[model samples]
Target: MRYETRLYNALGVRLTAEHSLSTGQYEFMWFIGGWDGCGANDLAIAVGATSKGVDCMEAAGW
Candidate 1:
């Protein structure tokens, strides 16, 4: 058997928790579905968040 531990930074954890909310999770999913090959910065602008936050989401495998 194999196992892996997932680690999250403070911001990452916060973002994760926020995304767990019904509205936040829905928005996140909407963004993912609506993504159209835009750059991270562009996506950040479109989503009203920082690029760093987007990076965190990417790291979280969302």
Candidate 2:
């Protein structure tokens, strides 16, 4: 658990510093890009987010 937290935080820092993206945005980009026919609900489930949250991400141009 401790190592996982540290690694996650480190990944977040690197993503932000290098790409100017939040972890969620990075995840969304990769997931949506790789998933050719996925809907927002599927993305929400895959990313552990709510459908409403996925809608919000789309609205925000994620």
Candidate 3:
């Protein structure tokens, strides 16, 4: 059997749509959408990500 992959951008990372969110991406989206008063550090911790990730998201038009 063979599997097909779809490439897309999440933040600035080129990722396969078939794969689930990375540890950080999932948390970032969740915190941003579900909570209030979320700061940069808060988002970083929530997503286990860094400023670069944020930059990527921003460039992606988030």
Candidate 4:
């Protein structure tokens, strides 16, 4: 089957974070929301860190 390509706006709710170190581009993510409210799109914009995630904003002290 042939594939189709497209551009995405901020409203796109990323289904997954497919990071590409070579080009720094994410692919195969799904966009699932409307862009209207200021913070409404914030949740859809950023993905939460997993249990093994690194938090630079957190304190270094254990």
Candidate 5:
């Protein structure tokens, strides 16, 4: 579990440094970018977050 968390955090840092995206934003983009028609609620469920989180992402111009 520790190894997994470390690896995930390392990847998140790399992503943020290279692409200016947090892991959550990357996950959100990965899901929405693949689908044709995905709603905020769908993304929230997919990412295991609340719909309001998705709304915040939208507000940030995600």
Candidate 6:
């Protein structure tokens, strides 16, 4: 059995925050969902946490 790991970097990141809440949550959900057969362009546009400059690794399994 193997393991999978995903890395996200937000070193020089900028986020838009307002009175209600930060757009971070929404973006993360959409980005991750895209990988789960949610929509398209899962690699385009930095949506949220799991956005651009993110690294994902899926190891072999049995």
lDDT of 5 at 53: 66
lDDT of 4 by residue, 1-62 (tens): 12222324321334223321111112211121243442323433344432112132123221
Error of 1 at 2 (Å): 46
Q: Which is the leading candidate under TM-score?
A: 5
Q: How far is candidate 5 from the true structure (C-alpha RMSD, Å)?
A: 3.6
Per-residue CA lDDT of model 5 for 9-60, tens digit only, reads 9999998898677997888678888998877666554554557666677786
* Candidate 6 TM-score, C-alpha based: 0.24
Q: What is the per-residue lDDT of model 3 for residues 1-62, given as tens digits with 9 covering 90 to 100?
A: 12222222343243325334454575567678787876678655555456777778777666
| Residue 25 alpha-carbon offset, candidate 3, angstroms | 1.6
**TM-score of structure candidate 5:** 0.63
Of candidates 3 and 2, the better by lDDT: 2
Q: What's the lDDT for residue 21 in model 1?
A: 31
Query: lDDT value for candidate 3?
Result: 0.57
lDDT tens digits, residues 1-62, model 2? Answer: 99999998999999889866778777767877887787766655455465666667678666
Candidate 1 residues 1-62, lDDT tens each? 12222322444566557764334544655776787775656656455465666566667666
Error of 2 at 27 (Å): 1.3
Lowest summed lDDT across 10 adjacent residues in model 6 is found at 53-62
Model 2 residue 38 CA deviation (Å) reads 3.4
In order of appearance, the predictions have TM-scores of: 0.38, 0.59, 0.43, 0.15, 0.63, 0.24
Better candidate by TM-score, 1 or 3: 3
18 in model 4: Cα distance from truth in Å?
A: 25
Name the TM-score of candidate 4.
0.15
Q: Candidate 6: where are CA atoms >4 Å away?
A: 1-21, 37-62
Q: For model 3, which pairs clash?
A: 24-47
Which regions of candidate 4 are displaced past 4 Å? Answer: 3-34, 45-62
